[model samples]
Target chain A: MSAESITLEELDATERFLLAIADDEFVTGQRFAEWVTVGPTMEEDNVLSSLAQDEMGHARLWYELIDHGRDLDTVGYNRRPSERRNSILLETEHTDFGDTIVINFLYDTAETLVLEAVAETADDAVGSRATKVLEEERYHLEHATQWLERLVSTDEGRRRVTASFERLLPRSADLFAFDAAVGTAPSTAGILSRPTDELRAAWRETVEETISSLPLEVSADALEAAVSEPVTNGRAGEHTDALTALLDSIHAEGLPADHPASGYHA
Target chain B: MKLEERIAAGQLIESGDELTDEYRELLCGIIQFTANSEFMGAFAESEWIPRAPSYQRKLALIAKNQDEIGHAQMQYQLAEDLGRDREQMLTSLLAGENGFGNAFHYPADEWIDIGLLAWMLDGAAMQLQHSLMKTSYGPYARIMKRVCREEEFHIRHGEHIVREYATGSREKQERLQAGVDRWWSRAVMFFGLSDSRSEKSERMDELGIKPKTNDELRQQYFDTYVPKLRNYGIDIPDENLYYDEETEQWEYTPPDWEEFNRIVTEGGPETQARLDRRRTAFEETAWVRDALEAYDGTTANRFANNITA
Candidate 1:
C-alpha cells in the first residue's frame, strides 16, 4: 500500500524499524572510526576511515526520515544505551583486523538484504532512502567480501577469520529479530512487500554460501548452531554492556545535555 | 645546464629528471621529512577522535585526519618519483633512521592541545607550505598547492575550537591557556634555528630549493599569530617576546635547540609509544598484505570481466 493508505500505527512500526537500522549504522560507524590512524596500511587506513564517514552519513539519512524531532547528534549522542536499538554485534570492540572484516561482512550482508526489502516498500520516503543507501552498501559489501576471501587464503589468516566468525556469528541473530509490530505491521499493511523472515533467510543464505566458499575447516554443525541460537532482539530494546559503555563514554566526554528535538516529520 | 645555472633561471624540474647528486639528496630529504610529518601528525590527532566532545567535532577531526593521510600519500608519491620507496621510508621512520618535525614529538594530551595543534602548529606549517606553493620541483609544488588548500580549512576548524574554548567556562579557558603555554615554544622552534647558525639555509636558498630562511618564516608566523592569540587572551609564554620596529621583526627567547635535537633524534616522550603502536599495526597487518600478494590475480580479473559482461 502507498504511505497515504497506511494507518498511524503501521507508520509508527515503520519508524521503529528505521530507527534500528539508523542506530546500527551510527554505532558501527563510531566503532570503525576508532581505526582511523591505526589501520594496517596507509591505503587501508584511508579506505576504512572513508567507510566510517559513509556509514555515519547513512545514519544521518535514515534518522532524517523518522518522525523524531532531534538533530543527528541529539538523536545519536544524547540517547541512553537502553534507548538505543542497534544490533549488539556492532557494539562489540574489534580486537583484530580479522574481527573487523568478519563484522563488516556479516553486517553488510544483512544490511544489503534489509535495504532490498525496504527498496520494495510502498513508502516512497523509505524506498528512495534505501536506494541511496544501497548504492553505498554495495561497495561496503564488496570491500568486506574481498578482504574475507583474501584473509582466508593462508593458514594463519584463515585461523583468525574463522575465530572471528565463530565468535561473531551468534551475535548476527538480532539483525533479523524485528519485534511483532515492526516485523509484521509493514508487510501486513502492504507498505513492505516482503516479510522480515524472508529477508533474514536471504541474508543467511548469502552469508553461509560465502563462508562455505572460503578455504577453511568450518563445520556445518557450527554454522547451524549459530543460525539457531537465541537472539538478543535489539529492535525490542534489548542490548549488551557494549552499547551501555559506548553511550556512557560519549556522555562522559561532555556532549551537551539538551539536544533540541529535530522536529522531523515523515 | 649546471644545477646552479638552473637555480638562477628559476625553472621547475619535472619528475624523472636528473639533477646534481647534492640537489637530489637535498630535495628527497626535504620531501620525505614533510611526508613523515604528515603521517605522524595524523597519528597524534587520531587519539582525540574518540574523545571529541560533539558529533560535529568528531566528524571534523576524522575528515582532517583523512586529509593529512592524503597529503602524506601525495608527498610519498613525490618522494617515490625522486627514488625513495615507501617501505624504506616507513621502516627508517620506525627505526629512528628518519626524522619529522619536532612539534609532533610532544604529546597532544588534551582537547585543548588538539586546538593548539590545529591553530598554532598547523599555522606554523602553513607559513612554510604557503611559501612552497611555488617550490622549485614541479611535482612537489603542485602537491603543495592542494595541501595548502586543505590546510586552510584545517586552520579555520582549529581556530573555531580555540575560540570556543577561549571564550568558554573558566575551566575551559584555563585549559586553553595551559595548552598554549605548553605548545608555544615548540611552535616557535618548528621553523628550525636562526639563519646565521645554519649554513644549509644559505646553500638551500642559493639552490632555490628553499626560497625563505627559517628565521623569515618564523617571523612571519609570529606576525600572523601573536595578535590573534593576544586577542584570545592567551599568553605567548615567552616573556622576552617583542617586536623590533627597526628590523621589522619579532624576536623572542630562542627554543631549546638541545632539547629539539634530543627529541627529534632520540625520540620524545610519546615518540616511542606512537612508534610502537605503528609498528604493532604494521606487523599485525602484514598477513593481510601477504594474503593479497598470494591471491590469484585472475580471480579479480574474472570478476571485472563479469561486471563488464
Candidate 2:
C-alpha cells in the first residue's frame, strides 16, 4: 500500500536500501571508470565501460529517492566515511579489465534483482523511480551477463573469471545486510518488502542462475553460510579497507560539518 | 599487401610515387587531421569519466573515450612511421598547429550532450568512415571497421537519451530539447564545409583513400539522422532541410564553411580548455604511466598474464 506519511521509520528503511544499492554502484562504477584510460583492448574496454556510468547513474537515482528532501550534491559530496555504505565488491581495484568485468557481473546481477523487486513497491514515488533505474540496470546486466558467458565459454576466459569469482564470492552477501540506521522491516520501514532471510535467499538464487554454467566453487552449503554470515557487512555501514578509502575519496566533495576541514577553508 | 603486414606498415606511398615535398605536405595534413581529431575526441570524451551518472555509463563512456585515444595512438604511431615523431605530433596538437573535429572542441555540457554527440556526431562520422571502408590504406580501413562496430552503441546511446527526453518530465524534456537545439548547428557543421570547392577534397577523393565529398557525407548524415530526430519527436532546427527528388539525396542550406574552418583551425570554443584538461590529466597521471614505462620486469613477475599478455 502507498505510504500516507514519510515516517522516520520508513525513511530509515528507504535510506538503508538506497545506501546498499548506491554503494554497490559507486564502488564498482569508479573501478570501471578507471579502465576508461586503460583496458586490455579498445573494443573490449569500450564494451565493458558502458557499465561504469550506468552504475553511477543508478546510484544518483537511488540517492535522489532515498534522500528526497535533501540537496543531492550535499548528500553525495558531503557525507562522512562512517555515513557512507558501499559494498566491498566494487571497492576492490585492479588493472585487469577481466577482473573488472567479473566484479561488475556479480554486482549487476545482485543489483538487477534487488531493483527489480523494488520496482514493484506500492509507493508511487519509489516504484516510479525504481522502474526508471531498472531500465539502466537492465543494460548493465546484459553487458555483464554477455561477458560472463563469454568468459565461461572459453577455457582461458573461464579460468581467469572463475579465479576472480572465487576470491569475490565470499563477500557477495554483504550487499543485503540490514542497518539499524535505516531501520529493519519493509512494512514498517519502507525499504524492503520482505524479511532479511527472504531477500538473502532471493539474492542467492539470482547469483546461482548467472554462475550456473561456470565451475564456481560456490556450493549450496557455502551459499547458505554466506547468506547467514557475510565476509563483510556493508549494509550495516561496515566496509572493507579499500571501500573506506573509496568512501573518503567519493565523499571528498561532501565532508560533514563535524569534520575539521568541512567547509570553505580553501 | 597482407592486412597483417599493413597493420604495422607505419607509412605507405604508391610504388611509382617518390616522396616529394608537396606530397609530404599533403600526407602531413591528412596525418595531422587524423591524429589530432582522434586525440581531440579522446580528450573531449574523457571529461565525463569521473562524473558519469552510473557505474555502467562511466565504464562505457570511458571505454568509448579510450577507443578514441587508442585510435589516436595508432594514428600517431602511423605518423611516426612517416617522418613525424610522436613529440612533433604532440607539439603541433598542443600548439594548435593541428586540428581535430569541431564537435570535439565543444564541452560535453551535460550527460545528454555526451550521448547526443556520441549518437549524432559520431553517427555522422560513420558516414565518412563507411566511405573509407575500402580505402587504399589497408590498416586505416580495418581500424575503421572495428571502430564502426563499436560506434553502433554510441548511436544507440544517443537514441536512448533522445527517447528519455521525449518521454520524460517536461523539465527533463525541455533540457534535452534545448540540448538538441544547442547541438544542431554543430552537428550540421560536423560533416565539414558543404559548398567548399576545396582542393583537399578533390585530391583525397582522387587518391581513393577518402572516397566521399564533404557534401556527399553531409547529405548522407541528414538522410539518416533527420528521420531519427523526427521519430524521437525532435525538431530538425532547419526548415530549409529537405530531400532532392531528382538527385535522391538530402538538400539543405549549407553551414557557414568559413566559421567551420575557423573554429577547427584556430581552436573551437572549448578547444584550449579541453586540451588543458587533457594535458593536466596526463601530467597528474604521469607517475602511473611512468611506473609502467619504467618497469623492468616486476609487472610480469606479479601478474604473469595480467593484461592479456
The per-model lDDT (C-alpha) reads 0.78, 0.62
Across A1-266, the per-residue lDDT of candidate 1 in tens digits comes to: 01121122434777777878888998998888888878766777787788888888888888777735555565655566666778888998888989898999899998888788778864677788899989988888888888887777678899888888888888877777665327455567565567767777788788888988988766666566456634676666678888777765554443222212111121
Instruction: Please state the error at residue A137 of candidate 1 in Å.
Output: 1.2
Q: What is the C-alpha lDDT profile of model 2 across B219-268, one tens digit per residue? A: 87888888888887788777888888998987677767787888887877
| Error in Å for residue A61 of model 1 | 2.0
Structure candidate 1, residue pairs in collision: A1-A190, A69-A261, A69-A262, A69-A263, A70-A262
Which ten residues in a row are the worst by lDDT in model 1 chain A?
A257-266
Cα RMSD for predicted model 1: 5.5
* TM-score on B-chain, cand. 2: 0.83
User: How high is the lDDT of residue B206 in model 2?
Assistant: 49
What is residue B180's positional error in candidate 1, in angstroms? 1.2
User: Which one wins on DockQ?
Assistant: 1
Point to the candidate with the largest TM-score: 1
Against the true structure, what is model 1's DockQ? 0.33
Instruction: State residue B301's C-alpha deviation in candidate 1, in Å.
Output: 19
